[model samples]
Target: MKTLSEDLMLLIEREISGQASPEELVTLNNWLSADKKNIKEYQVLQQLYRGHQTLLRNNIVNTDEAWQKVSNKIEILQNSNKKTIIYRWYYVLSAAAAIFIIVFFAWVFRINNQVVTIEAVAGNEQFLLPDSSSVSLKKGSAITYNRSFKKGRSVIVKGIAYFDVKHIVSNSFTVITNNTLIQDIGTSFLVNNTITKDEITVFSGEIKCINLSTKAVINNIIAGKKIINYSKGFVVTDFTDTNILSWKSGVLDFPDVSLTRVLEDISLHYGITVKCLPIDLSNNIYVKLHFENQPIQEVLNEIKLVTKLQLRKGNNEFIFFQSVKNESSQIKKQK
Candidate 1:
C-alpha cells in the first residue's frame, strides 16, 4: 500500500473541492495515472469529502446516532464472509478513518485561510478587528484580512480609513494599499488611497512606509507627519489636515478655506458630486464654516445662504450657480 504524503493529500483535497488550479489538476492527474493504489486513495478521499458534505446538509447533530448507523453498516459488511468482499470492506473502513482525519485537518486549514472583508457601502462604517484594534472606514472604503488575523496582523485597504491599531510587540500591524505597505510602530494612522496616489498620516506614535513595487523603504513617519506617495516618488511632510477624519468624526471644518475646496470635501463626505456652473464663483468665494452631522440639504442650504449661490439637486449630484439676481446686478455693473 502506498501512503499519501501531506502534499498529495492537500492536492487531492483541492481536487475534491473543485478548487485545484490547472497546474495542480495536471499534477494530480499525473499522480493518479502513476499507480493503481493512488487511484484507490483518491477514490476513498472523494467518498470522505462527499460524505462530509452530506452530513452537513442533513444536519447530523447527534454523534451517537451517527456512530450507531456506522456500526449497523459494519455488522452488515461483517456478515459477508467471502474473502474478497471482506478484504475490500476492511480496506474501506480503515481508509475511512484516515480520510476523515485528513478531511478534518483540511477543513481547519480552509478556515484558517479564509478571507474576511468589511466594506462601508452606504455610510461610514466602524469595526473592531480580532486583536481589538479599531478601524473607521469612510463611505466607499473597504478592508480585507484573513481569518487568522491575530496571528498575522495584516490588512488590505481600499479608499480611505482611520486605524487605531492595538500594538503587540511581537507582531506588528501592517496595512497594504495601492502597492504600498504601511507597517505600524504602535500608531494611530489614516490612509487615503486613490487611483493616482496614496496618502498616509501618522496621528500618534510612528509608522514605517514602504513601496511594495520597488521594495524601497519610503520613510519612518512619526506623529504629526505624512507621506504622499505618487507614481514618480514620495514626499514626507508635516500633517496639516485636521478634518481628514471628518467622515468618521461627523464634523466638517473649513476655516477660511476656498469654496471650491469646501465643496470638494462636502462631495467626499456626502458621497455626491458638486459642480459650480461658472467655476469662477467657487474660486472667488471663501467659506468659514463648521458643520456636525448635518443633512446634505441643510449643509447645501447653509452654503447657499453664505455664498449666495443658487443650488440645484440632481441624482447623486448638486450644482451651484450665481443667482439670476446677482448675475443681472453684475451685468448692469459691467454695462
Candidate 2:
C-alpha cells in the first residue's frame, strides 16, 4: 500500500497558523468526519505542536550540561546505593531524568526546524523551493514553507503566483490561499487570491481544491480548468483563453471580464485609486481589451472611449461615470 500523502500534514500546519482557508477548513473537517481515528491522530499532532510552542517560549537549557548534571547525580546515587536510606528515591529520580533528557532533545530538534518566507515587492520574483519546485510571484505576493519541503512539501501563498511543482514519490505539493487550499497531485498552476475570490487555474496535471470552512473537497480539477471560491459558493469552469494570464508577461487582457475586477487589477498594478464608479455599470457590462505596460492616463482614456464615460482626476484618484449627452456634445464642440 502507498504511504499517506503529505497534503494532510500541510493541512495541519495551516490549521496551526490560523491561515487555513475556508476551503481548507472544510477539507480538514471532512477528513475528521470520515473517521474517529483521524480526529485522534489530528488532536495528538496538535498537542505536540502546542507543546513545542510552549517549550520554545521558555528559554531552553544546554542539553549537554543538563545531561551531565543528571549523570553526575546518578553516579553519586549508584555509589551510595549501599546506604539503604535513599536507594529507592535514587532509582525514581534516575528514571525521571532519563525521560526528561529524551524529551528535551526532541523539543530542541523540532524548534530548530523553522519555516522560511519569501516575498516579492516592487516587481515579480522567482524562487526555487527546497524541493526543486519553481515559484513565480507577482508583485506583493508571498510564500512560506519549512526546510523539509521535499519530505513534506507545502506552502502558504498570498497574492498571485505561478507554481511549477516538482514531483517526488509519495510526496505532495500543496498551496494554501486565503479561501482555499490546493493539493497538487502533479501539476503546474496559477493561484490568485483577491478580496472577493480565490482562483486556481491548472496548466497541467491535476489538483484537489479544498474548502477550509465546509470540509468540502473537490478532487476533479484538471488541466485547462479553473476553480473559484467566492462568497456564496464555488465554481469549477474550463477556460480556453490562453492569454488569461498575460500579466505574467507584462500584458493585461480583459476578455469580457468585469470592469470592477479590471479596475482592481489596474489599481493593484499602477498603485492608483479609481473611485466613484457609477453603480449602474458596476456589474452589467464587460470589457475586452489588452494593455502592455500602458500609462495610467492612457488606460483611463481607453476606458472613456470604450465605455463613453467621463473621468475627473484629483489627488491621484480617477472618478468615472457614464457620459451625459450634454457632456458628449461639449466634448464634440471642443474637438
Q: What TM-score would every model get versus the actual structure? A: 0.65, 0.61
Query: lDDT tens digits, residues 1-335, model 2?
Result: 22446998888877765566555656775675455587557655655565566565664545567667666666666555456528746665876677687776676465444556789987889879987889999888888776545555668788899999897656667786656767887899999987677888999988898765454678868998998887556898896655555557767778676667677777766768975356546455467878997888898899777766678987868877766663433122110
lDDT of 1: 0.75
Cα lDDT of candidate 2 equals 0.71
The alpha-carbon deviation from the true structure for residue 263 of candidate 2, after best TM-score superposition, in angstroms, is 4.0
Best candidate, lDDT-wise?
1
For candidate 1, lDDT tens digit of each residue in 1-335?
66779998898776555465545544665565456586556655655555566556665444466456556666777667688667867766875676567556554443433557799998889989999999999888899775556755767788999999999987778786655677788899999998678999899999887664444675568999989877566789998876778888899998887788888888878878987878776887777889999998899999888877788887778999987668854321111
Off by over 4 Å in 2: 1-68, 74-113, 194-197, 230-233, 240-246, 254-265, 275-288, 302-310, 321-335
CA lDDT, candidate 1, residue 59: 53
CA lDDT of each prediction against the hidden true structure? 0.75, 0.71
- Which candidate's TM-score is highest? 1
User: In candidate 1, which residue ranges exceed 4 Å CA deviation?
Assistant: 1-114, 314-316, 328-335
After aligning candidate 1 to the native by TM-score, how far in Å is the CA of 65 from where it should be? 23
